[model samples]
Target: MPTAVPVAALDPTDPDAGAVAHYGDPAREQRLLDNAAGLVDRSHRGVLAIPGADRLGWLHSLTTQHLSDLAPMTGSELLVLSPHGHVEHHAVLTDDGDATWLDTGDAPGLLTFLERMRFLMRVEPAEVSADWALLSIVGPQTDEALIALGVGPLLPPDLLAVPDAKFATGSVPPRPTAVYSAAALQFGGWARRMPYGADLLVPRPAVPDVVEAAGVPLAGVWAFEAMRVAARRPRAGFETDHKTLPAEVGWTAPAVHLEKGCYRGQETIARVHHLGRPPRKLALLHLDGIATDELPARHTPVMLEGGERPVGFVGTAVRHYELGMIALAVVKQNLTPDSVLRVGLSTAAMDPEH
Candidate 1:
C-alpha cells in the first residue's frame, strides 16, 4: 500500500512502519488523553469496501454482530469464527448507505475469507486500503474538531448492550437511534469509533490537506495502544488465540449479538456463554514489581507467582502515563484475581474486570 500523504513526509529512517511513532514527544499519551488536537497516521490499517445491493444482509449472516437491519451511517463490529468458535477474523464496520467498509488489522486474510464466502451473494469485497487512508483523532472534542475540517462525526457503536423490554431468544431488538453521523466530503468521510474516537477515511491524495488542517497534536501508535490497553480493549492478534471465544475477552458484551441467528461458530459461542465457562479469560496485569523500563513482550509466559507451570501469556504491554507498567494478559479462566501472577520474572496482580 502507498503511504499516506500526511505522514509520507516523515523520515524514512524512523521505524514503526510508516505511521510516525512519535515526533520527539514521550508525553504523547498525556497530550492525546487530555484532548489535544491530535493526528494519528493509521495508514497501516487495512480497509475493505463491499458495495452491492445485498451487502448488509449478506454480511449479517456471516459475522457475529447484528446487521440484518443495520441503519445507515451506524457502525458495529463483527467476527468470523472457525466452526469450533475460534476467532478467525474481526473487523469494525460502518455502513455508508451504499457500501459497507470493513476496517481491520488483517485485511488480506479477511478479504480472502470474504471472497470465498461470496459464493452466490451479490457482494463484492475488494481491498480499498490502498485507495483510502485511515486516520483518527481521539478525545471528547473530536466531533467538533472533525466538523471544522468537514470530515466526520462517525457514529459510534452502542457500547452497552441494552435488551429490549419484550426481547426473547431469536428475536431482533429495536435498533437504537444514532447520535452521530459521518461527514460526507468529496475527498473522504469520517466514522465515530468505539471506546474513544473518530476514524477518518480519505483517499491517499487528500491526506496532506486533512493532516495540515487538523491543527492537533500528531501522535503515534504508542499513544493509541497505551489508551487501548488501558481501556482493556481486546485486539485480534493480541488477545485472541486460535481457541478464543467471544466471552473470553469481553468482546461479547460489545461485539456479539446474542439473539442473532446462526452463523459460523455460533454453536460454540452459544454453548460457552450459557453452558460452560471459557477455557481462558482476559485480564489486566499491573506489573508493580518491575524496577526498570524493560518490560515483557507479547507471547511472554504468564504464571502464578512462585509457580513454575504456565497458565497464560501476555498480550499488549504498555507503561501508562499514570498507571505505570501494565499489560493485558490472558490467563486460565479459573485463576483468581486475588492471586499473585508473574509476567516473565516480574510479579504482578490481575484485574479480573477485563
Candidate 2:
C-alpha cells in the first residue's frame, strides 16, 4: 500500500503512482546505462534484517539456496515455494557480520511467512526497508564511480572462501563503506562482468549525498526494466505468479539447489526435473516492427499463426535500445522456437533465450 518516494534532490516526477519512471529522457538514460555509470534508486525493493545465531541455518532449511556456509558480505538468491512447488516469493540475500539481510520485492508477505515459521527458533526477522536505501551503479564506469565516492577497494577475490586468513591478516575493511564483490551479489543489486556494474546499499539519510557524489546521470525503472528483459532474468509478479514453478521460468539452475536438503517444494521440483518437462517454458518474443504502433499490455493473449486459441500470455515488454520491442513470455513447451505468434494483431517471433 505504501509507495516509494523519490529522493527530493533529484526532483523526479512520478510516471506512476509513488514511483519515478524516468528522469525526463528515458532513451538517453538507457544509453548512459549501456555505456557509462548510471545511478538508479531501488528503494522500492523490500529489505528484511534477520539476526541471531541460528539465522543462517534456519534460512537454509527454508529456502531453495544452500545458505549453511554463506559468508559475510557474500550474496545469493533463493526462492520461497508453496507446498505444491510453485514459486511464492523470490529473495536476494546478503550477510554482514552481524545480520543477514533478505532483499525482496514481496517484503511484507515474506516477513509474515518468516514470522510464522519462527515459532521456537532463535532467529529474529524484522522489516527494515524504511531504515535503509538501495542504489545501483550500472555500466562500464562502475569501478571508477565507486572509487570516486571513496567506497573502494572492493570485496576480496573469493566470496565463498573462508575469512579466517583475511581476518588474521587484518584485511577486512571497516563498516559502512566496505565494497562487496559483484560476483557475490549476482542476482540483481550487484554488478556482473558481462554487464559490468555494482550496487550500493547505504543508509537512507545518505541517499542524496551518495547519488550526487557518484557523479553519474540517473536512470529510472524504465531503463532498468529494458536491461533486465534483455538479460532474460525472470522477476517476481512479472514473469512469475503464485502458481508458477521454478523450472517453468528457468530459475532452478540459479535459485534452487537440487542436492540440498528438503524444503517446502523439493519433492515437486525433483519430480519435474527427473521425470518430466515443464508444461510451458519462458521465451523472448520480438515484436514485429510494422505490426502495430502500441506495445501489447501485460497478460495479453499470445496465439500461434494458424491457431484460434491462445497458447500463452505476455509477461513484461519493453522497447530495448538494441533489441527493439522485445517481451518475455511463457509459451507452451511444444511451440517451436521459429514459430510466429500473435498478440492482438501484432506479430512476434519466438526466441528461446532461456
**Quick one: best lDDT, which candidate?**
1
TM-score of each predicted structure versus truth = 0.88, 0.83
Model 1's alpha-carbon lDDT is 0.75
CA lDDT scores, all candidates in order: 0.75, 0.73
Model 2 lDDT tens row, 128-198: 88877677777778777767676544644223322331133333222211123433221223332222366
Q: Give the Cα RMSD of candidate 2.
A: 8.2
Candidate 2's C-alpha runs over 4 A off are 1-16, 153-196, 289-291, 352-354
Report the lDDT tens digits of candidate 1 across residue range 1-354: 222232335445422356765566646545565555576778888999999989988888888877878777777778888999889888878788989988898999999998988978898899988889888887776767667676545455455453443446745463422223455555666545554777778788998887776666667677777777888889888887778888888777667777777899998887787654778988888897455567787779998877889989898888788787889888998888798887876888887672
Once model 1 is optimally superposed onto the true structure by TM-score, how far is the C-alpha of residue 236 displaced, in angstroms? Answer: 0.8
Quote the lDDT for 345 in model 1: 67
Number of clashing residue pairs in every model?
Answer: 4, 1
RMSD versus native structure for model 1: 4.2
